[model samples]
Target: MATSRIRERSPKRDSLDDLELPEDYVPYVPLAKRRAQKYQKLIHKKAGLDFGSNYEDGSGSGYDSNDNYRRKNKDQNDSGRDADEDDDEDKQPLTGPQAGISLIEQSVELRKAQLSAEEQKTDVQKAMEEEAKILAAVAERKQLASAEEISKGIVYKDPIKTTWTPPRHIRAMSEEELAATRLKYHIDADGEDMPPVIKAFRDMKFPKPVLDYLKNKGIKMPTPIQMQGLPVALSGRDMIGIAFTGSGKTLSFTLPLVMRALEEETKMPLAKGEGPIGMIVCPSRELARQTYEGFVGIADMLHKGGFAQLKVLLCMGGINMQEQASVFHGGLHIVVATPGRLQDMLNKKKFNLDLCTYMCMDEADRMLDMGFEEEVRTILSYFKHQRQTILYSATMPKKIQDFARSALVKPVTVNVGRAGAANLDVIQEVEYVKQEAKIVYLLECLQKTPPPVLIFAENKNDVDDIQEYLLLKGVETVAIHGSKTQEEREYAINAFKSYQKDVLVATDVASKGLDFAEIHHVILFDMPKEIEDYVHRIGRTGRSGKTGIATTFINMNSSEQILLDLKHLLKEAKQKVPPVLEALEDPMEKYREMGAAGGCGYCGGLGHRVTECPKLEQQQKTKNSGMSRPSERAGNEM
Candidate 1:
């Protein structure tokens, strides 16, 4: 009974084998067995045998025993023959050493054949190698052509011949009259046989079209800078022009560069990829753009006067490099560029300075401040021949002086006023506004000034915040900073310049050589870290002999050293100094009292003496560390 109960088990439970399967179902096979069969088929195929037909029947379960045995025996016979051949090659004659040498030679030949087969390249690979060789040859040829062109010295014309002769009246002026003119304009010119100060643009012997253009712009008399700078620059001398911002410094170099470029073009026309007879290097794109426009305006006038049409190119960051490069194809007469972009173009071999005999570094001090000294030097090296170097800047510090000495050949130094001096036309007002209340106080400051106001902040984030705050308060404002795109910066600048916007919030990017006509007021949202920056920021207004107002906000957060410098600057300009700034103790006051010269002799910073200069220390440290120093304003652009 017990056996029957066990046998009856689970109502005849359905086993896996008893279940019906689909017609296409395949039985499971061990993974190892499947892989072995796969490898066997691959080996058979590689041995020039049909895998499926030689190993199994169509059903894949049966094999011909006789055929398999015959195939195996045939393979074994072939392998045996190869082994015998290898052994015979390795074998040495029992009685002679020559036999061993023959055996070694046979083995070496076998290896050589194997390596040749392994090293064979595909057709596509071979074609690529041939193309590379052709490209290298072409590059070498172009390099040699460039080298030959540079060696010819065709672009290096005589400076004296290229320079325009001054008018009879200017040349005839006596030393007494010239000294009187220099005294009247506060011009301190230092050089051998310095050119007399020009009272009018016509006195410099500029092309009639240039004179007409100046007249049309209502520029009746030359400004202080132009009076001396024009004559010096036109007299075929490398000149260092130190003048305040908006003091006609741009025209001082621009006009001369145009004249030189025009002379070169007229004498020998520029061929494709042949020019940039003149180059003006600026510190910022905005300044470069302004200079380019000024050059274009003069060039247009020249063209209208039946002169050869001058081609000018603006090279700077955030612009289409391809478009800038396109000008080289047609041969541009002049290039107005920032140091960064110009250096980039040179390094990439996009253009050469072979024909650039006229070079100007506008805002040279600012360029140095932005850590462009190396870039400027590298760019200078591209010029194969001597160039008439002109350095114009609002401030000329010792660093710039040293740079000028190395870059220029016996340069003339022309100063309209004290170097690093603030523009006297601006009425500077300083107020203590707490950081938290600056946004609230900014509105009051704007109401005090007219439209076309420029508001500057040291930090780009502060610029954006001020712009957003002004916009929310119903102020028509545009903002520019390093973070903005190039198009945005251009639009902002144009909008402010055209009076389309009542306010412009920006960083130090706009504080350099940008000329915004008729700006009524400039507001500093925060005190600049450097006193030089403060001067340039305020200089944005009070341009072209017009009086304007500058309001600066300071607080406890401001550096005492900068405050002392500001106090001194205000006093030097005869402006009313705030009690807070006047009360700030100069860190180097003791040194000054001990007969040390005021301010840093090296950098023109009033904060510390040359020995205590932080910038100089940093430079020394960087040099000692053998690391390249980064530009402080490298990323700050609009």
Candidate 2:
């Protein structure tokens, strides 16, 4: 059997051929045995490495029994220890030479953060300032552009893309259509004497009530402004009427509003005592009152025609709220108020504007100029957004034009008069004088031809002082200012109207909505702050086809820029500059070169009494760069 000791191969021999079977194989090794095997392997492996037999130095067989264990422990300890040693070496104290670089790096990081923070703050502030200036300039350009458009008579087509040319056959229509057309066009005057716009209204054939109102007002003809405005306003469209003073702008909207009101009243009556169906906001108390009066006069004619009850209530400052509140309680069919008083009443819930269907802002340009824009917004917000809006102004500024654009939805703009339009009836004249000669010249003008003149002063104090001086000089004069009481202001207006006072000394308060029917002259005692204001001030006169005269005081000591502005305005109005003040552009500078003393001789160096140097007076150039210097004078004409 020993001679033939070769193992026999089984069918599965190939699969298990390389397997080694241990004589003491256990299903699972014991913990001690497993650990011993691991140590033995470590000893073998470490002994094979260059670290040498120190890893296996103990016990027998050139391999200490403890050698494998010691070797395994040494390897394990060395792995951990070596890693730790490398970290400690890295963490070892830095050399003195490397410290500066570390500190410098940290400082640079800190400075970067600080610089970033400063830059952020500066950027924010600069952005805010730039935004403000941009807004202001944008506003200016817009106003100038609108004025230019109106001046140039640039008309854009309607958004709805409908053709609006009047029918030629209508002119040859039968009696019924012709009558209807005439009514629509508002043929109030004689046929041959009618303006084309009036003829157009006559051809439209509006309702009877509208025609009746027009006829009653003796508006036998529509003005150019009215022709452009009425058609759109009557169509339930928002509108802006831009025309010079006395171009019948008031009638343009007034006739249309009255017609709409009459139509509504005749067609259907409002719920009893609900509220006003319409409202009109004016810039100043005087203007609001006058507008109310005008509304009342026209409304009276409508009432007699069997129309529904139409009433007007006035709300303004310088009056008792109790009286105003009483009016509100009675309920109004129409309201006219300054923004302040109107806003106050609105907040009290005295009357809800939800019922208001029509609104008009008369003198919208002047309202913004007087800084009533916020108040205007407050009032407009109270009305239903669906209501009709009509904005009327003598001249549209960018701020005003923008406001009108936003406030009015899809408005038809009506521009009246010629390009570079001024109240043609107003004869504008600029007077150049020594600062001292102003009062003397004013007094001379008063003595020669003062016919209920309105004198514009730059300040309220100047208004009062001028009034006093005029009175002391035996001239009948009155003043209106912020300080005046409601009664005093109204009384002053009455006095001016009654011809009791031949001259009125006023600041810009008198610039708007002041309708003194016979104002023959406007005297600019001081130049206005804005070029636009020059237009508003002069608009006070030459109203409704009446001729008027405007005189401005240009001093030698005043700014050349202001004088140039005045010159430009006058030139635009097609008026010639008087020769006396033309060459005195830099009066003060010229006088200074002439060795003038503490006071100017022309304007009294002050803007007052000639006893003082005219050139020494406070200059009236609100904006320093656009006007002439104060006049130099040696005597008081008064």
**Which TM-score value belongs to model 1?**
0.72
* Candidate that scores best on TM-score: 1
TM-scores for every predicted model = 0.72, 0.60
lDDT of 1: 0.76
Candidate 1 runs further than 4 Å off? 1-161, 324-326, 586-596, 611-633, 636-638
Report the C-alpha lDDT of model 1 over 1-638, residue by residue, as the tens digit: 98998898745747787776875344444555544544454445455665443222234432465557445433433555532443453353521443324567878988999878757954434444554454343222111112434356444333443546678877787999989988987999997778778887766777799999999987888999988888777777888889887788988988888888888888888888888888998888888889999999999999999999889988888888777555666778998888778888889887788877888888887786566666776786687777788888888885567556554556789988888999999999999999899989998998876798999987878888898999999999999987788899899999899989999999888998888878979999898877788889999998899888999999999866667777888888999988887676766655555554567665577665554455556656775886644433554332
- Each model's lDDT: 0.76, 0.60
Instruction: Report RMSD (Å) for each prediction in the order shown.
Output: 24.3, 18.0
**What are the clashing pairs of model 1?**
none
